[model samples]
Target: MKEEKKPYFPMFVDLSEKNVVVVGAGTIAKRRIRSLIEFTNHLSVIAPEVNNELLELETAGKIEIRRKNYDREDLYDADLVIAATNDHQLNNDIYSFCKCMGILVNVCSDKNKCDFYFPGLARHENVVVGVTASGSDHKKARAVVEKIRTIL
Candidate 1:
């Protein structure tokens, strides 16, 4: 018999003033970074190849960019960590480190490796909603968010 995965708990966190570390500068990391910057000022990106947009954010003091490979020391001060790098092994290493340290982390590559799943978020002024399909179906989750957005 196969066991089913537990569903993600829906909760709103106050990252408004927390130190959030993003461990990549690729497309997925870029997406998360864009959304997180709207909420936090202490968003740090550690990547070897950060794109122009992230550099611009660093220039404007919205985020701090460290252009290099991720060191485990980065997690020491992070309130929340997003591991969106292309390396699966690195993401797993981060997940394990966060688990031991009791830090919240989201691994973009694998659902089983994630301590938290990033939901499709829709914000209308003060009203914000997040939709997730338990990581089974991302398209459905996105569609649901879009539908909710249309109605709200």
Candidate 2:
């Protein structure tokens, strides 16, 4: 018997009122945070220490930064969670927790553990495009996103 892998559907969501939480503050997490902030106002970041840019965003009231280790309590209000920690175990734990809570989760290090994959985005006035290579080729997805951006 063989397993089947279904393609991820292209579903555009409204994040304006959703509570999005990113569980790491490193470069990968930062990029996700940056993209999310453009669409949602209720974004929370949890980590022991974050970079200056995140600190500035916190100071400016764009996102909430919790300067501490991750706990399940931190996700109490999250509608969507991005597990972007460098610690694989931690990311897995977060994924399990999110699953139990029925929360949508993206684990940056493991596609199999993710409930959703972040897409390369292109946004123009009154239009938004999302592109992905199904977690196989990010560079290709980005190139396509760039082309889409130019078209927009």
Candidate 3:
């Protein structure tokens, strides 16, 4: 039997006034962006093209939008990053870059390559509940988070 190489330690982070970049504008990326935008207005989206929702957010001046491919230089001052692009190789590259730079990163494609797992969270009043299945079962984590929402 093989042992699990990575162990997930869950914790909350303060994203306020932080430079956070989401490297995709697709469904998954948009979902993550929504959560991030609530925390920080200093959000940036990098992609070749963006969806209507993301564009609308950009138009509203909620975030900084870069309609182009990811550049390695983008990671320079990034405090936190989410690699949610469709290209597996690019996402992995972003993960590696973040790893080398000692930046906190979440690779939505490959959890093993991720420095952190973005947990399913529910914010209620002043309390926030986050749940993770160690990337083993995301559905379960979301389901639990949903339950927490109702109880709060």
State each candidate's clash count.
0, 0, 0
* lDDT score, candidate 3: 0.86
lDDT of 3 by residue, 12-102 (tens): 7787889999999889999899888878869999998887888889899898988788999988989999999889999989988998999
Off by over 4 Å in 2: 1-4
For candidate 1, what is the lDDT? 0.90
The alpha-carbon lDDT assigned to residue 39 of candidate 3 equals 80
> Residue 61 of model 2: what lDDT?
91
Clashing residue pairs found in predicted model 3: none
Clashes of 2: 0
Candidate 2: tens digits of C-alpha lDDT, residues 1-152: 89886667888889999999999999999999999998998999999999899999999999999889999999988999999999999999999999999999999998788877788999997698999887778899999999999999
Which residue pairs overlap in candidate 1's backbone?
none
Better-scoring candidate (lDDT), 2 or 3: 2
Candidate 1 residue lDDT tens string, 18-137: 999999999999999988987887899999888789889999999999889999998899999999999999999999999999999999987667767778988888798989998788
Candidate maximizing lDDT = 2
Ten residues in sequence with the least summed lDDT for candidate 3: 4-13
Question: Between prediction 1 and prediction 3, which has the larger lDDT?
Answer: 1
lDDT of 3 at 15: 78
In candidate 1, residue 131 scores what lDDT?
A: 93
